[model samples]
Target chain A: MTTIDSPPPPTLRADSLQAIGVEDMGVRYDLRFTKKTTIRRSVGQILGRGSQEPFWALRHVSLRVVHGESLAVIGPNGAGKSTLLQVLAGIIRPSEGAVDVRGHVSGLLTLGAGFDRELSGRDNILLGGAFLGLEDEVTRRLLPSIIEYAELGDFIDAPIKTYSSGMRARLGFAIATSVDPDILLLDEVLATGDANFRAKSKARVIEIVRAAKAVVLVTHDMSWVTEYSNRAVLIEKGRLIMEGDPAEVVALHRQHTDEARAASAAAATAAGLDPGIAGQGRR
Target chain B: MSVTSEVPAAFRNAADDPGAARLIREGLADIVSRRRLVRYLVQADMRKRGADTILGNFWWVLDPLLQMLVYVIFVTIVVSRKTPDYPLFIFAAILPWKWFTTSVVDATSAVASQDRLIKQIQFPKLVLPVATTTAGVVGFAFGLIPLAGLMLFYADRISPFLLLVPLIAVVQYVFTLAFSILLAAGNVFFRDLGNVARHVLRLWWFLSPGLYSLAVLDEVHVVQANPILKVIANANPFAILFEAYRKVIYGAPTSPPGLPDWTSLAVLLLVSVGFLALSTVVFKRLEPSFAKVL
Candidate 1:
């Protein structure tokens, strides 16, 4: 597996990355339970207190990415990986800190994120391009290339609802990369589609990283981390646990997962339940 | 790739401390830059709304025509018809009223309905409400074709002032757009507002001079005696617009006083512009909370 050494300082990194940066960003969400009666809640809120509880989705996380850098974020579910990506994409507002993105940002948090299912693929391309802030004429000019890259052919005119899952992924990936944004945020988008499409998408992503300013990828695929990303960060329970070389971070994550599994198994055995049965229930 | 050393203004402004004026300025700038997105969204909505039906876009014109037919039948059988050219009279008011009611109602839920798009994409939040209003205008424009046919049948009633119809339509559009932006932004926080607006709009329709002309009210001595009621009756933007359409289309003289009251038109314009400015400020203030609430 390919591994990168420690990254250079921010000034030196800026020379390679262009001008992308993230500084001390944090996001918080209030967990509201509407169990109280409306009148009672209103009265309480008016009195300067309410039942809503607050929790941080991401807390005091800081990272600097420059041009040509692909930073991989790996964590277990609910580790705030997706939240961080959403915050970077400007979809979510941070509660405690600031994020400064230098240029145009394209995000693929989910397949066909803003696509209208009733619209044909051709129309969706126009709509999606517009959402990315591309003018209509520019989208028109990019149409042939998007279709060619997606490999949808005759299906491009069909409504998106009729397309297979893989086809939707291909179309989304094609349109997102077509714009060549200065900053790209991907949340497991590279893991979609069949092997052939995956290879093509990977190649396209490589081109984007080489050509564009910066990229932040959130994925559990360790192979992708080692091979593609120059830096990796492991976060757990909304806290940044470690950051450095991809291989080092992956090794730390594996050790942490094993320890957690062993501790859970021991707790189950102590309670007179088979660990295997506990694992089966989870599966 | 060569990169600029200076941070872009977008990044230099701290997210936490962006003042209200700054937010409004940035939001407006963002919307202006993404104006093509608004147009595309409007077109996509206009097409997708009725694509599955046999009538398709025919419904845009058909829906208002059917409403006008119901009012015509009611006026002919039940109500006292003081106005000549009754069908043309109802057409003038109903066409613009349909635009106002539908645009306001559709826009009320525009933000909440696009939960996925708002949560995933980073485009201006104002686009959703603005696009919905524009889509309503497209339907209203189609509804005008039949009105034009009715206008031709009453060719003698047409006036030189008919050139003012487009100006009146622009005023009404601004009025509808302001209400739409206000309601769309409010409904994000209070989902019940959408349901409330439907019933409220039904009452509002009757309050306007849509079904019956102001001439009927002018004949009532009781309506004229109450100064408060008279002022309210005149102050309504819908009444002002419908009256403007009647004056321009039917060459009808202004009621209560025969002379044209340009003050009403000026008042309507002022209210529409002032309301638009107010709603934009409110929308920008509420925008950052939308994703979390949704």
Candidate 2:
């Protein structure tokens, strides 16, 4: 089978160095007991009678990413890293401030997130590509490469539900990276697949970053952050803690983690709990 | 490669935040550009629904045929005996009613059902309900084959008015599309609305002239006494549509107060256009919060 040619270069303005800009962006979600309760509260609120607590997933944060830049976001669990990516992907609307993204944006926030389980993997590639705003002809042209990169072989014709988790990840990664997006948002997508496949996907991710106008990566892998990204930002409790060189940021993140672990261990000892148990509880 | 001096129209300008009009325009443009996505989703939905069945697309036709058979058997054996061409009559009404009811019901959950897509992807959410309605329309078109087979026995009644079937279908399609969009958008916020929709559709079924002819209802004095009920009965698009189907398909006489007048078509046209505009506004307003809610 014939392989697809390289994707055409992105059409961007010569003066446009910024691929993404965030001005004090914030996201707040209302915590509802149930759908009915939410509805009742909404009606009550409209009537000026009810008040509900809202969870602020991310607070005011400002950042700018220029073309050909790979910005790695490092943070602990629930640090609003994914929330920031989601906002940039336009999946989540900010409650305060604004996010401005130029060009065609694609994100691998969740693998096979939109796939229909009953449909064949071949069909899903088409559907997934369409979701990314690729035309049918373009997706069809890229189909052979997607299948080859996924290494599904004959299984490509089978329904996606039959594939293993790793296979699903491979397919998702292949389809998401098929196009040279102007801005790419990745949320730990490269953390899947076997060792060999991981190496292959990591190389592919590097290539995509080179081709993309800008890239935002959220990952816990410190090595990947230090090696692949030029710059990094650390977020804690929904606030931007620091932004600097990837290596420096990684070191700072490690320092913060160690301090947090030590502080928790001391607190656990004071509470008469096992220090080892406290370390596990910190997760 | 050197970047182009002319900025691509697809790019969002960071200088000015997009307002409601720009958002709506962008949403529509996104949907139009991603029409293939809509087609694929509809095909995928149709395939998934029937993937387990050996009959495949045949099931689409069989479902309504089975429904017509049950209604025919019940009406002929249990309800009444004097009604002529009962299967054909019930079927003519049932086809459009099925389209309306199924589309609305399916669309009521369209957005809510695709929680994954809503949460993970950032495309025009309008495509979800629109695609569901289109799938219903496709199924409705398939159901027509069996309707045509039944009409073969009543071939003598066929006339140029049979051409009006497509026109009638377009009217119903618009009505259903508008209604589905509203329900889908509303359900995203108030999921209880979907639960209420099931019962409302059941009540709507009886209110329409699906089982019995409008002529029979006109004979009942109680329906005529109350102005409210009279207006409600007359304003029913299903009743008007079914009556139109019978008039065109069965060559039945246009009985005064029984046959649908121009006012009925006018009402349908107005409702279709009005509801479409209303639903578009509502859907756009509710769209921004869909991901959070989902």
Candidate 3:
């Protein structure tokens, strides 16, 4: 038997890159306000100089996805997982760092970003496909499959505003996955859809990943991470705290949460906020 | 390069290269693609809005007709007396001026309003202003059909110079695009641009002869010190185009009863092009920040 080297040669699911590469990237978002003298910012200005300051959404976060690699970004709320995905999708700009992506990226942060509420589901699918950078010819070819996959049935001709939020998610997912983007960024998208549709969507996503060049799955679902990801990264605050086998990293994260909680409590107290504030916040 | 490095002179120098060729090729392609999406979005929006009113699409015609009637009453009854066949003159000038002013105002807020979309998409930011302006142009076109019918009844004479309507429309559209881009880009950082635009447009209207005939101001010193305003009043594409409409419809001189100075038209075109080039550079340089601020 030939000796296998280089960490099992990174499973190749496509003819092209079996992995996607991301260099040392940093993203800084300048949340520029129109200088409105709000009570909050006004107080800050009175207390300190430089009335405005930029919020760093992502700071020097970098990871690589092998063509056919599945990576899960597991983090607490506001840990910048979605921001990393947005940077990868090129939707959000990085003020300081650079991101060099190898293939097309389809992001699933909001299911309805491309859907016009006024348009019919059919029209919206075509529009969504076009918005995702699909050519008219490509959309025309994929129309039937996209509609069928959405499971929208006769409702495809009905106005999308009439569709439930779940239905919209299904439609958006179908349209996005139809193109087989080289790299996929899924941000808590699996949480949407009914049980029956959820299973189907998961199967479809699996099918996509089976053929996809790379995928970065950002979700709070630990089970999904364990089941789907070959590699897992846990980000705390703005930095990566752990990375390795999904199960081992998650176990380590669970063990370290007590320490993390203590630090957060101390920091919260220092900042004059309740220690239990974020915990009491929305899930 | 590390973020801590000093501002390198070489890199800073590259910022002033004008970047016209790269912008024309890459920027235009990106803009054209985004414009396609904008077209679809506008179509969907129009359908939704058109279906909301009780009269369905007829409101497009009625809205302008009603406005023309108001302007007619205001101009003939309240303001200018020299507007011969005042109703027809007002109707002729109303549609184009409405097109220019509304389009500019609408385009000023176009990008600012779509802050969510701009922040989430990497396509050219110019698409929003251009799309808003296009929507205004389309609305103006819809309003023109009824105006043409009014012209047939009130002002029956016709002239060949009427062909300038489309050419002048192009000039106005290009000029609006340049202004909209500048204003829209500026508004991204300065929230007061919208307010400034309203007053500026009001001032521009007074200077453009949209409500008054240029013949009334032949000897005014304001016309001498500000020839562009004077030319804007007389050969102002909006005024000149409507004057062309008046000539085609009422056998009147197309432009203040004098030969239009080709130099002014050339100058307007040059100024518009200059503003456009300037706005493109500024917009591109600022684009990296749009997704964050917007």
Scoring only the A-chain of each prediction against the true A-chain gives TM-scores of: 0.85, 0.85, 0.80
Per-residue CA lDDT of model 3 for A172-228, tens digit only, reads 888767766666788887877889888887887777766666678898788878887
lDDT tens string, model 1, A1-283? 2333345566675444544555677777764422212344556665878556687889988877766678999988999998888778777777776776767777777878778899999999999888867767778988999999888999999999999988898898888778767788888887889999888887777777666567789998899898888899999989999999899999999999998888777767755766566675442
Q: What are the candidates' individual DockQ scores?
A: 0.37, 0.35, 0.18
Clashes of 1: 2
Each model's lDDT: 0.78, 0.80, 0.67
Task: Write the residue-wise lDDT of candidate 1 on B99-204 in tens digits.
Answer: 8888998998898887777877776789889999999888888988887778788877766676677788888888888899999988876677777899998898
For every candidate in turn, the CA RMSD to the true structure comes to 4.4, 5.4, 6.8
Cα lDDT tens digits, model 2, A1-283, are 1111222234542446777888888888885533443466678776767566788889879988877778999999999999899888887778888777877787878777888889999999998877766767788989999999999999999999999999999998888878777788999988788999998988887877778878899999998887778789999989999998888899989999999989877777755766666656654
- Candidates ranked by DockQ: 1, 2, 3
Q: What tens-digit string does per-residue lDDT give for candidate 3 at B1-294?
A: 111111111111112344666665655666666655678666765687586579876887887788878887776677656555666666666777777787788777777776655544445677777777788778877887887777677544434545556655676677778878777777776667788789977877667655665666767788777768665466455555555444444444343222234455566667777777777777766766666666
Model 2: chain A TM-score against the true structure: 0.85
Q: Top lDDT: which candidate number?
A: 2
Task: Give the lowest summed-lDDT range of ten residues in model 1 chain B.
Answer: B1-10
